[model samples]
Target chain A: MMTFLVRRLAIILPTLVFVSFIIFGLQQLLPGDPALAMAGEERDPDAIAHIRKTLRLDEPIAMRYAYWMAGVVQGDLGISLRIQKPVGELVLQKLPVTLQLAAMAMLVALLIGIPMGMLSAVKNGSAWDYGANVIALWGLSTPNFWLGIMMILLFSVELGWLPASGYVPPAEGLGANLAAMVMPAFVLGNAIAAVMMRHTRSAMLQVLSSDYVRTARAKGLYERAVIGKHAWRNASIPVITLGALEFGQLLSGAVLTEQVFSIPGFGKLIVDAVFNRDYAVVQGVVLCTASAYILLNFLADIAYMLVNPRLRS
Target chain B: MTALLEVEDLRTSFKVESGRFQAVDGIDLRLEAGRTLGVVGESGCGKSVTALSIMGLVASPPGEVAAAKIRFEGRDLLALSADAMRDLRGDRLAMIFQEPMTSLNPAFTVGDQIAEAIQRHRGLDRAAAWARAVEMLRRVHIPAAEARAHDYPHKLSGGMRQRVMIAMALALDPKLLIADEPTTALDVTVQAQILDLLRRLRAESGMAILIITHDLGVIAELADDVTVMYAGKVVERAPVEALFEAPQHPYTIGLLGSIPRLEREQARLDAIEGVVPNPLSPPAGCRFHPRCPFAEARCREAEPGLGPVGPSHFAACWRTPLP
Candidate 1:
């Protein structure tokens, strides 16, 4: 296990470097010049030149990449051209909000999805199974942003039960934070839940039909015990893999959801940076999201070993 | 003495897309205390279904099991409530399946699986159940019973896994053990070893055994009484020696003849012609008429029921004496 972890970490370093290079190249290729965006409609060429020189935008692409890579190694993520502040500091400020939102969304997805999926599998052709399938289909088809808007209109505008848009940190009264987060989380979580439910149902259906489950039943175990004790653990392996992939997606793909809810998360920060031609902030956020994706996959491998002892060797 | 298990006119059918298919049709079985009853048949001839029906393990909707009477220890098993049947299973009645690789739960340790049965039926605590699991493993002749108990099914060989399954089934000391092709998936040596273990266990516990298999050699080796089935119906039943020495039904004679004999220098082994008919649409009269060499026009026109041929022997055929 120790050797496995060491090898995984070694692979992660090169992947992160490759990801950083891609993020830097993509940011550099964006249409708008960062120097001009910072200058903000200034007519003077001399002023634009001075801004470009200060930001080191005048250097060759390779030189600029080397400088950026060097700064990344030294824990300096460069300065945001629009805000004139360290990109690292900006990301640090917004990272918690995104993390909290993604975590809450995942929690909601799992709590509802797994049970619904199991029920669908157990009661295969029953009304509950049909109903869950329909709901899953709807959730999968509906865009998160559109769902967020609909939820806001229904729960916030019509019912006046939750705040329409915004965020509140958990430190400032748990109720208010949860109230502010509910709609956005639901919107983001619904699609993930649908995917989870479908994957879990298929996995469970396959496991339930296996000969071991028949043996369990032959042992005189109740249907509940057979499903829960014998079948659930084996079925959960695929679901865990799905969950890790969904979580990585949530962290990066929450841009439209964060936009819809007016949450000041990393997704929103990256979006604003794109419009403002803040290359450093864009590169920083991309690097962070990419690292998170890699880390989540690594954690999933560990979880697989824990769930299936056969895989330990 | 009262029989440990007595099943009469037991019929099991499945409702598939094509139509209703009878898997086990009008079968009768009896097992006396401490004795072995071998049910021999070709594949798809209801050998396993009869065992499952007795255990009430057949799934409904797709499959249904009905019988005139299924008495176990003087109680009507078919009339027991689902919960009552559950209590009987793994406690009063246990079963071991054919495929050991697929039968034992891969996620759990061999000890834990056996211990679960002990805990469920015997009401033993975890530690005591664990110890009993080791004891059961030892009884099955598995080496390093203590350490092997902690190993999962995947870590064990096919023979060892089957032994673990036997340990689990016997952990609660059920009065009746239904072994459905228990040694079919095992190697020849392992099959002999498993049969020996079962024989020893039965002698020790005085528990009745219902051994289902296609191998006549197995039946001859382990069974006191033998039942021969052809296409979901029992065609002949007699003592082991009578069935082998004076087989009645053509199906039974064919089955015996098919076994390769070392004494005979035959160019080829005798094989029963044709396959077991599809249960979905079996022959209108006799299920095995198409495959039977002695099948006549009357045999093809009407099904035959069991009739006395000799002492404690029965045969189902149009012509018992064969002219």
Candidate 2:
């Protein structure tokens, strides 16, 4: 078990390195030059030159990558040319917002998904199963942007129940923060919930039909115990993998939902950085997101060992 | 002298796209207390279904079980409520299945699984159940029972896993143990060891065993009485010695002849003429008539009922008292 953990942990470093390398290399290939983009409206040669030298844009691509990598290693994500602030500070400021949103979205997904999936599998071909499938399909197909707008129109504009746009940090009062973030979180989570529901349903269906499940029932275990314990434990292995990947997706890819709700999160931060040719902010955010993906996968492997005893060997 | 299990006209059918097919077609059985009864047939002869039906483990919806009476130790099992049935299962009546590798949950340690059964039925607390699980493992001759109890199902060999299954089934000391093809998935040597284990366990506990297997050798090994089923219907019922000695049914004779023996020097081993007829489209009348060498017009026109052929023996064939 220790070896498995160590091996999984070891792979994270090289993977992050590769991701960082790719992000840095790919940033150079974009159509517009960051030095020119940072030179302001005048298009002055002195300003462009100054910007190039200052940001090491004048250096060779490989040497510049090495510099950026060095800074990354030391937890210095470099300075955002547009904002004149450290990329790390901006990322740190935004991290909590996106993290909270992602966590809530994942919670919603799990809470709605797993039980629905379990019920769908248990009452397969019944009305409950059909109802879950229909809801899942609706969730999967509905655009987050449209759903976000519709929710704002109904809840914020008409009913006057919630603020349609912007974020309120948790320090401002927990209820207000939740009220503000809830719509955007749901918009992001609904799609993932659909995916989780399908994965959980299929996994549970396979488990419920397994020989061990039959063995479980033959032991005279109650239907609840049989499904909840014996069957659910096995079914959850695959769902955990899906959940980790999905949560990583939620963290990195809430751009549209964030835009619709005007939430200042990684989505807007990273998207704005890409458009403005803000290399430092873009590289830093992608690196952080990539790290999150790796860490989540590592956590997933540990979870597998916890649930499935065979992997401990 | 009384029967521990009395199954009468027990029919279990499955509803497929084509139509409903009876897997266990109104079979009757009576197993005396402490005796090992072997139900033997080719694959798809409904032996496993019968076991499942008796244990009340048959999956519903696609499958349904109906019977005149399934009495176990003076109680009609079919009449019991779902709750009552659950209390009896894994406690008073337990079962072990064919694929030991898959029978035990892969997620749990073998000991945890055994202890769970003990905890459920015996009402022992976790620690006491764990101790009992260790003891059960030791009884099944699992080496290093204390340490092995912590090991998962995947860690154990097929034979070892079968032992674990046996331990779990017998953990509650149930009155009846329905081992459905328990050794079918083991090596030849391992099969013998498991059979020996079962025989010894039965002797020790004196619990009636209903073993379902396709292997005649398995029947000869552990069975006190033997039931030969073909196409989901009993063709012959007799004491182990009598069935082997003076087999009346042609299918029984064919079964006996089919066994390859070193002493009987023959160029070819005898095999029954055809596969067990498909349950969906079984031949009219006697289910085995198509495969029977001595099949006649009368045999093809009407199904034979199980009746006495000798003292304490029965055969279900028109020409059963064969000259």
Candidate 3:
């Protein structure tokens, strides 16, 4: 396992280098000069030139890239041009909220989607199955932004059940933070749950037809045992993959969701940086999200090994 | 001796886009206490379907027990509710499937899968049930029973997994055990061992077994009574000895001839010609007419009903004129 981890990490090195090159190139190509944006239009040319030289803007792009790469190797993520703060500090400040939202959304998806999918598979062709399919279809088809608007309207504006926008740290109190985060989480979660439930249903249907399931039934197992114990566990292999992909997507997929909920998560921070042309902040966030996607996929592979003993080979 | 299981006019079919396909057409079979009744037929011949319908494990969608009366110890099996059927399965009756490799759940420990039925039907607690599972495993001659119980299905060899299947089926000492090609997937030596174990278990438990297979050797070795199925219907049935000595139906004779016998010297074993007819559009008269060497004009026009040919031998063939 350690060897496998080492091998994966080795592969990730070149990928990170490639990603940094793209982020550096794309920021360089943006319309407005950071020197002008930083110093303002009225600043003296000499003063602006001095700031550009200090920021290494006057240096060759290759030289600038080498310097940035060296700093990255030394655990320095560079400074945010707009905020004039360390990019790492800005990322650390916003990382927790995005992680919490993603975790909550995934938890909600698993709790709701797994059972719903099992029900659809178990009661197959019945009204409950039909209902679950319709719900899944709606969840998959409806845009997250539209769903977020409806949630805000129903839960916040109309029912006064939750605050319409903004975030509260869990340190403030568990209930308050949950209430603040839930609407955004719901918007993202419903969409993920739809995908997960469909996967679970299809996987379970396949497992249910296996000869072992027939043997289980021949042993006179109750329908619940036949499904929950036998079919569900076998079906979980695919569901686990879906869940991990959805989790990775959450950090980015929640960008619009975060905007609608007015939560200042990493997703929202990245969106803000893009519009304000904050190169350092955008690079840091992109790097972090990409790393997360790779790491979660690795974890999914491990989870697959854990669930299916046959894969130990 | 009183019969333990009697199935009469049993029919099962599946609904497809084309039409209804009758899998097990009208067939009658009986099993006396402590005896084996082997129903022999090739794949798609409805032998397994009959076994599943008997256990009420038939997948409902696209499949149904179209028509039948199945009786177990004078009680009507079909008349029972689903809940009641559940009670009967694994308690009074149990079934072992073909493909032992796939018959046991890959996710579950072999011991837990077996213990589940024991606890559910016998009302044993977890500890006692587990102990019984190990004991049953030992009975089936699986090596290192106590330790091996903790292992999953994939961890075991094909033969050992088959032993576990038999152990699970026999956990409750069911009155009637339906073994549907239990040894089909095993190697020849392993097959012999399993067949030997089954014969011994039958003797010890005095349980009536309905063994489904297309292997004449298996039927000859294990079955006291034999039923030959052709295209969803019973073509012939008689005591194993009598049927082999003098097969009344042409299909049975063809089947018996197809097997290479150690006792008989021949230039070449007789082969049954042609394939089984599609069930949806079976032959107008005798379903076996297309394949039967003795096919005649009447054989293709009118379906021959099963009737007694000898004292206990029954056949469905018009070629053999009625007495």
Candidate 4:
């Protein structure tokens, strides 16, 4: 297991390097110049030249890349010219907020999706099966942003139950933070729940028909024990993979859902950075999301070993 | 003595997209305690379905099983509630199936699976069940049962896995064990070993065994009584020696002929010609007429019911007293 972990880490390190390279390289290709963006309306040539030299825009691309990477490696993500703040500090501010939202969304997804999937599979060919599938279709098809808007209108405008838009830090109060974050989290969650439902349903259907399931039945197990204990254990393997990948996507898929809710998270930060041509903040956020995806995949492999003894070898 | 199990007019049908078809057509089976009854047939002849139907493990809706009476220890199984049936199963009745490699749950250790059954029916605590599982494993001749109990299903070979399956099924000391082609997936040597293990276990437990297989050789070795089926109907049934010595049904003769023997020299191996009739649309008259070489005019006009051909033998053939 240690050897496997070492091997996976070896693969992850280079992937992160490649991802950082892409982020930095893409940021370099953006049309707006940092020096020009920093300059005011009464732009002087010498002032611009001095700013360019200072920012190393006049240096070789390789030299500039090396400089950028050195700072990134030392936990410096340069500075967002628009906000005149360190990009690393901006990312840190938004990370926890987004992480909390993503976690809540995933929690809602898992709570609803897995059981529904198992129920659907066990009650296959019944009305309940079709009903769950129909609901899943709606969840999958409806854009989360539109769903977020509708939820806001119902829960906030009509019912006056939740805050319409904006976020509260957990430090203020976890309940209040949850109240503020709930709608957007659900809007994000329901769509992912649909995907989880489909994956879990199919996985369960396959497992339910397996030879071991037949053996389980022959053992005189109650239908519930057969489905829950024996079948679900095998069925959940694929769902685990889906959950990790979905969580990784949730970190980035939060973009539109985040936008609609006015939650100050990575989505809003990145959007503002892009519009303001704040390349450093965009690079930092994208780099972080990519690393998360790689890390999630790595964690998923470990989870597979833990859950399926067949893979432990 | 009263029979351990009495299955009468046990019919099973499967509703498929094409149409409904009878898989086990009005079959009857009787087994006495401390005896083995072998149900032998080619694939698609409903032998496995018969076993499943008896065990109440057949999937519903697509599959349906009905019988006039399926009495186990004088209790009519068909009259029992679903829960009552479940309580009986894996307790008074246990089953092992073909493809032992796939039959054991891969997600759990072999020990956990066996222990689970013990705990479910025996009311044993976790540690006691675990100890019983290990003991069961050892009884099945699995070497190093203590260590092997910790190994997952995949860690064992096909034969070892079948042994594990037998261990699990017999953990509760079920009165009747229905083994559906249990050794079908093992190699020849392993097959013999499993058969030997089963015979030994039967001698030890004095449990009635309902061994389903397509191999007459297997029936010869392990069975006291044998029922031969063809195209979803029992064609012949008799004590093992009588069936082999005076096989009355043509299909039974065909089945016995198909077995390659070192003693019986032939230029070419004799194989029963023609495939099994499509289950969806079996023939109007005798189901085996299309495949039976000695099929006569009366054979195609009407299906023959089981008739006494000898002192203790019955056959379902119009020309059973073959010339």
All candidates: DockQ: 0.75, 0.77, 0.77, 0.83
User: Per-residue alpha-carbon lDDT of model 3 for A181-295, expressed as tens digits?
Assistant: 8888888888888988899899988898899998888888888888888888899999999898889888753778888888888877888788787877887788888888888
Better of 2 and 4 by DockQ: 4
RMSD in order of candidates: 1.7, 1.5, 2.2, 1.4
Error of 2 at B291 (Å): 2.0
Worst lDDT run of 10 residues, candidate 4 chain B, spans B314-323
Q: Which stretches of candidate 3 lie over 4 Å from their true place?
A: A1-32, A60-63, A73-75, B66-68, B263-265, B321-323
Worst 10 contiguous positions by lDDT, candidate 4 chain A:
A33-42
Error of 1 at B146 (Å): 1.2
Chain A TM-score, each candidate:
0.96, 0.98, 0.93, 0.96
Q: After superposition, how far is residue B77 of candidate 4 from its true place, in Å?
A: 1.1
How well does candidate 1 score on lDDT at residue B144? 95
State the lDDT at A99 in candidate 1.
89
Question: Residue B275's C-alpha lDDT in candidate 2?
Answer: 85
* TM-score against native, each model: 0.97, 0.97, 0.94, 0.98
Mind giving the per-residue lDDT tens digits that candidate 1 earns over A48-164? Answer: 999888878889999999998899889899998888899899988998888889998999899879998999998887899999999999989999889999998999899999999
Where is model 1 chain B poorest over a 10-residue stretch in terms of lDDT? B314-323
Between the candidate structures 2 and 4, which one is better when assessed by TM-score? 4
Candidate 1 clashes between residue pairs 3 or more apart in a chain or in different chains: none
Question: Tens digit of lDDT per residue, candidate 1, span B1-323?
Answer: 88888999999999888889999989999999888999999999999999989989887867899999999999999889999998889888999999999998878898999888788877899999999999999999999999999998899999999999999899888899999999999999999999999989998888889999999989988999999988899999999999999998999989888899998899987898988898877897877889888888998889998888888899998889633
Local error of candidate 4 at residue A18 (angstroms): 0.9
Error in Å for residue B285 of model 1: 1.7
lDDT per residue as tens, model 3, B183-220: 88999999999999999999999999999999989998
- Answer with 1 or 3, whichever has the higher DockQ: 3
